[model samples]
Target: MVQKDMKLWPFKAIPTADGDNFKKIVIVVTYKGEEKQFALEEISSMLLIKMKQILETYLGSEVKNVVVTIPAYFNDAQRQATKDAGVIAGLNVMRIINEPTAAAIAYCLDRQCTSNGATKNILVFDLGGGTFDVSLVAIKKGVFEVSGDTHLGGRDFDNRLLSHFIAEFERKHNKDISANRRAVGRLRPALDFSCSITRARFEKMNKELFQDCMLPVQMCLRDAKMEKSEIHDVVLVGGSTRIPKIQQLLQEVRDPHVFSLHNIPPAPQGVPQIDVWFNIDIDGILTVSAELVGTNNKNQITITNHSGRLSK
Candidate 1:
């Protein structure tokens, strides 16, 4: 993922362009003497020129057109940006597909979930180096609808650790390490190690960011009008989801005890005869309820595969 600082860099606009228009914010670099604005379209064209040359060299044939995919949650801006990238790369953009849609097709979701021709709710969890998002798809009668968070992703997690390391570096040296390229280059070696160390402290320090990972899951369930128990399974995609801290956040999302038990009303006992209680297990699958606690004749009900669904 491109860092936001680099993407929206030193110059916030193109000096030669129309006043206040931000075309150059996408790409501004020093060329020949003055800073020239090369739209991502132009830069992407440049990248394609080189890439096409390499492909022709290796394949001994001309490469003219290509197909591409983007994130499902990507809005119009991101989709347009990618098409621009393809156009500039010097190749005909054949077709653009959403990454999550590609994943569902690859996994044969319909064939897997369509049991007795009944619809099943599927959640696609996509976490990448730069972004994290979740998609809710309901497959029924060979059709589906999709909804999810497009902007969430892996980069936020990395940023948390990176920010931690930056603050630590600043605290130790009493110098801001983000001043300029030269300053950062001078200390890049030490900071690289800090990146590794940040992984160890990730879950410990980045609580809020981790909580974000669950919001999409909640949103998807709401939009789909399905309880968490209705989800047949979760599909984990992207490289960033493998991070231990990221993985742990998913576990917490599935945890039944993720919410406090304080609001739960104790089970009624025959119009106030005795106390009744309910408890959730850590796995969130089975729960045990005691008809009466601290009584020799206590009765309990063991429920297997409890829905574990949170009521709205």
Candidate 2:
């Protein structure tokens, strides 16, 4: 809810469990001239139902099964809650996999590295809109093992921007907009109040956050019992990874093999040979397959639930 523009919402103070066990997130909203309370999972079901409708329309068929990806740090209760959300959405939750793992699968497949008889250690950096995750994955003979996670992401960066601009607006106008939801929402887009933040200033404002991002990378490497040098490729995933400062920071960590499939420059060739496969079905079920490039040894995993989406 912190990530949402409260002004756009028709409700206020949506009650949530903070730092508590994975339980209920109850929200009240005005609907059809009536105020209604809903569990977070039910809200998720409503979104999923809408997504299912869109998917069915696009595919010209009914959709049921799905694979969801959650943050690697999600506890059992959180994972179960995600599956329950899927069930409530009328989807047969096929499997639950880590978000970083899914990104690794997508990366490996995009690079066609699963069929090659080469083993590589990959660092998957996934910084989405609301969460960040770093995974140290060993792609050995087609098997993937993941190792790190975090909760900070683009939303935190957003908060930094929000705080900065709110202070600026107050200084200029001599009025406090901090408590104004509509004011905050207006400030979010382009700072319509004639305020502009340069990239360097933005980076400076979130210097600590950029540094925090690296902590997970280091921890993942340590947890996986590997050195930074052992990582053959650093795969960047999610929208936040496109930020120039993020790219610069990651390049500082692993310059030569940093890769993103989003039209960023391709990694230099002759690095190594490997094979990987990733597929997403009509229902958004994800399947990852991989193998040593020249060997028959292969491994595969299917991911079905994505509860972390709700947390976002």
Candidate 3:
């Protein structure tokens, strides 16, 4: 603080837990950059308390109408849990929008475009930290309508890549990490970092880590049902997607038509266009409160509510 010549730290830390994995993160968005950290604690309650202090200190007052964005595929329990966290912190959450929807809203504002006209279908393919979502929407007269959606996110890919690494590591080092709990825990960060960086540049760091972990990466992409040319553009989103190997994979799939396929589309002349935003770090989930929720993992298209009314 003294060295930086700053008065206050605008960011606060939050603890996140995924399965048995626990991390402490201090997140603060500023004019300079955003900070996401790894917390080194195990207890969930302790993390929550620390987060409350951080929020209070940063805001310098009670929070009002907090906007919590989450995944579209999240169950009711998960959604309620998030809201409960906010309540624990003494905040009234006005609404919880999906991350992608928030990004889209920001994108629209940044581009000076309005969703007020004839219905246009848009496909939001959001790949995030742990999950992925594919949303089809119909925008008309300032309202966004959902047509369809799906989820096959980064977590699945990570698991696939990790499995690949374990197999290769055992074959080469004769050391089975998948069976060793301690080593498996250690291996997670390495694999995530290595795969992430490989998408940007095959630096020495990634090479040293995943030199033998090839088959898994190949298989994961294959499981995605994506080939060199099949994916017109591998819209890079989520922190994992930043890996240089990923970019390479996407590049190899292209037909020397990077511009026509990979590049973001340009805006229309008079009808201003918003840049389709996708986060390459976190998952973007939009919330929809309905009477029904899905209980199965195979999230097939099934509508729960039917009023039996259709109008032209």
TM-score of each: 0.63, 0.70, 0.44
On lDDT, the stronger of 2 and 3 is 2
Candidate 2 residue-wise lDDT, 151-180, digit = tens: 577877877887887789789988887676
Which is superior by TM-score, 1 or 2?
Answer: 2
Highest lDDT scorer: 2
Per-residue lDDT of 98 in model 2: 83
Writing each residue's lDDT as its tens digit, candidate 1 over 46-113 gives 77688789989999999988767677767788778878887767678888887766666655544564
TM-score (C-alpha) between model 1 and the true structure: 0.63
lDDT rank, highest first?
2, 1, 3
Candidate 3 residue lDDT tens string, 1-312: 122211112233455666778553534333345444523222223445676678779989754556778766567866776777666655676787775566556545654344454443333434555455533333333323221123234444555556666666777788765655446655767742243335434344345333222333344345444343432222333564454344333333333332211223355675432232222332222111221122211111111111101111
All-Cα superposition RMSD per candidate: 8.6, 13.4, 19.3
Best by TM-score: 2
Give the Cα error of residue 112 in candidate 3, in Å. Answer: 1.8
Cα misplacement distance, residue 283 of candidate 1 (Å): 21
Candidates 1 and 3, the one with greater lDDT: 1
